[model samples]
Target: MTRVQANLLLLLAAAIWGGGFVAQSTAMKELSPFWFIGLRFAVATAAVLPFVLLERRKAAVKTSRRHLGLYLAIGLALFGGAATQQVGLQTTSVTNSSFITGLYVVFVPVIAVLFLRRPPHWIIWPGAVMAIAGIYLLSGGHLSALTVGDGLTVICAGFWAIQITLAGTTVKETGRPLALSATQFAITSLLALIVAAIFEPVSLDAIMGAAPEILYVGVFSSGVAFVLQIIGQRYTTPSQAAIFLSSEALFGSSLAALILGETIPPVGYIGCALMFSAMLVVEVVPELSRRRAQAV
Candidate 1:
């Protein structure tokens, strides 16, 4: 796929994830965070398993130990981010949670440069900062309402950055986005199910009560969107992927206002504008500079 196509996939993933924030928040009324995450990813695993097996059938290369290790690492990061965000949603507004989670845009570029030694275009740094400020505005200047959940979501952003970075590398290397998705989904499910079994009340009724949300997030958010992320990253840099994905904050807050009846302050509209501008700049600036230099 072309870079533009890949970025569009990432943008679609962000939109799906934006709605996921609403499902996650509402489901907690009937389910605990661990129970929700467990069952959700359990469904995601089942949803993607068939595709993964088919992918293996088509590709003759056997899975390597290194690939398994990388998949495990990505799964662990996914679990950490999901757990923290879910638990954080219990105490925070969905808008607040999403805004804080958008911090991963900054973290992704930073991690790429610091650890992976991959530097993004200079625009990424400023764009990331702009996105953060916009995300903060999306919270409608309500960050002062931050609870413990907000703190956890902040940590969740770091885990998301780790997952995004690792998934980018692993998919580029293995060219097995389906297999990666299934593995990470299964691992996350198993770990969450174990935790749910131990500490949380995992009842059939609770599962049934939150069934709609479980299915939505599992099927679309975890299964489809994550797969898109893996596939899309193969054709795009992690930093640019992050800029696109971070628009989830904008989408989430808008969804919250419409579905959850949450109010967005006037400043929140300004935040939306800023967020869009950041994405546009990140996507267009480098290409424009390259063209101008060619002309010169």
Candidate 2:
């Protein structure tokens, strides 16, 4: 797919994840964070299993040990991010968690530069600022004093950055986005389940109570959205991908209002504008610059 199409897919993933915010919140009302995550990813693994088999039936790319390691590392990062975000949400306000987690848009480029020695295009820097500012505004411009949950959410953003960076690099090399998605989902499920078994109490009744949320998140959020992420990242830089995906906060707030009767402050419109501008800059500036350079 073209870069624009890929980025659009990433945007679609963000919208799905935004809707997941409600399911995640509601599920935890009856289930603990670890159990919720464990079950959610478990269902995701099952949801993706059929497509994985189908993909393998085609011209599948061989995975080397190094490639396998990359997939596993992304899974570890996914587990870390997922675990912390859910646990953190228990204490932090939704506004704080959403704003802080959206900071991954900023962290993505920083991680790329520091670890991979890959600096993003000049456009990404300002786009990051705009996206983040948009999220901050979307959160109603008030970040309460740091709580333990807020701290955990900070760590979650770092893990998200690492996962995005790794996924972008690995999928481009391996050309096996479906395999990467399945591997990461399975590994994340295994890790979350292990932790849940050790620390969280899981009752069948509680699981049943949260079944709808789990199934929705597992099938769409974890399975479909994450697969779109891997596939989309193959065509875009991690920094650019983050710019587009940062719209999750926007979509999340909008969905929360629509689905759960949550109220959004008036400033949300400004935040939405900024976020759209950010995505627009990232999408259009590079092409304009390239054309200008060619003309000169």
Candidate 3:
């Protein structure tokens, strides 16, 4: 796919995730965090089973036992990110979680340079700065007042950055994106299930009560959105993907305003503008550079 198409897919995935935040938060009313995560991913695993089978039949999907550790690592990072975000949402306001989790927009480039030995385009730094400033303003213009929950959400952002980078790199190395996606979902479900069994009380009635929310998040957010992410990242740099995916915070804030009737302050519009500009910077700068080189 073209870079434009890839980024658009990433944007769509972010939008799905943004909307899933509501289901995620609502499910908390009837389910414990780990139980909710476990059930949601279990449903995701089931939803993706058909695709896995189709891919196997069409492309002869294959995975090596040697890559088992990498898949497990990806799944563990996903579980860590999702679990922390859910638990953090219990105490932190949605605004706080949205903004704090967006720190991954910055974390991605940092991690890439430091460990992955990949230097992002020069524009990424300025764009990341703009996006972060937008997040701070979009999140009510202050970060001084933070709870323990906010801290956990920040940690979640780190794991999310790791998961994104790993998924991008490993998919290329493994040559079985669908299989990798399925394996990670399965691993995440199993891990969440084990944690829930130890820490949370899981009952059939509770699961039934939260079934709609669970299914929505499981099917769309975990299954479809994640697959889109793997596909999109194949065509774009992780840094670019990070910028697009971080728009989840923007979408979440907007969706919450619409659905929950929350009010956006006057400054929030400016924040939104800046965030949009940040995304454009990532998209436009590379094209501009390519054009300049061609002209020269």
Candidate 4:
């Protein structure tokens, strides 16, 4: 697919994820976080497993043990992010969880710079600062009284950043993006099930009651959207993909307002604007400069 097509797919994935927040938050009324998460990813694993097996048959090369290790690490990151966000949703507004999680766009570059020693363009610093200011505004213009859910969501964003960074490299190196996604889903589901079995009350009646939410989030959000992300990344740069995916925040907040009737304060809107602007600065400026240079 062309880059533009890939980006559009990413945007679709973002929209799916955006609405997924509602499913996740609503299901928590009837389910524990671990139980919900475990069941959701179990569905995701089942949804993606057939594709992974089909691809495995088509491709002669097998995944190495090293690649499996990488998949495990990626799965752990996914679990961290998903579990934290799930738990945070119990106490946080969907809008808050979404915007805070969207901070992963900012975290991605920082992670790249710090751990990978890759220097980002000059715009990254200003964008990061702007996003920080946005977070402050989103948090009622003060950082001192942030809620536990907010803090956990921030940690979720960090883990999401890790997962995003690893996904591209892992996919490229292994040449089995679909299988990798399926494996991660399996691992995350297993871990979540184990936790749910230990700490949370898991009941079939509850699962059946929340089946619609689970199916929507699991099949579409985890299975379809994740596959779209992997395919989208193959055709676009990580920077571009981040920008497109970051729209999940806006979509989430809007959906919450419309469906859940949750209203953000005016200041929170300003925060959203600032955060989105920061994302644009990071993604758009470089592309504009490159285009201008090409034209010249």
* Candidate 2 lDDT tens digits, 1-296: 99999999999999998888778877888999988988898898898888878887773568889998899899999999999999998876554565567767557777888999986769888988897777667556765534788689879989998998999899788766677777887888898889889988889999999999999999999788977987898898765786778788767767766776766467856866776676567656766777779999
Order candidates by TM-score, high to low. Answer: 4, 1, 3, 2
C-alpha RMSD (angstroms) for model 4:
2.4
- Steric overlap count per candidate: 0, 0, 0, 0
For all predicted structures, in order, the TM-scores are: 0.83, 0.80, 0.82, 0.91
Give me the runs in candidate 1 sitting further than 4 Å from their true place: 1-14, 135-143, 226-247, 279-296
What local lDDT score does residue 30 receive in model 3, on the 0 to 100 scale?
A: 92
Looking at model 2, the pairs that clash are none
Q: What is the lDDT of residue 282 in candidate 2?
A: 61
Q: Against the hidden true structure, what lDDT does model 1 obtain?
A: 0.85
Give, for candidate 2, the lowest lDDT window spanning 10 residues: 137-146
RMSD of each: 3.6, 3.9, 3.7, 2.4
lDDT preference between candidates 3 and 4, better one: 4
Q: Least accurate stretch of 10 residues (summed lDDT) in model 1?
A: 138-147
All models: lDDT?
A: 0.85, 0.81, 0.80, 0.88
lDDT of 3 by residue, 1-296 (tens): 89999999999999998888777877888999988888888888898888878777766435666578889999999899988999998977665566567667556766788888988879888988887777667656877644678778878989988987888788777666777777887888899889899978878999999999999999999788978987898899755786788788778767777776666567767766676677567656776787789999
lDDT of 1 by residue, 223-269 (tens): 88977887898898755785788788878888998999977578977
Error of 2 at 89 (Å): 1.9
After superposing candidate 3 on the true structure, give the runs of residues whose Cα lies further than 4 Å from its correct spot. 1-14, 58-62, 226-247, 268-284, 287-296
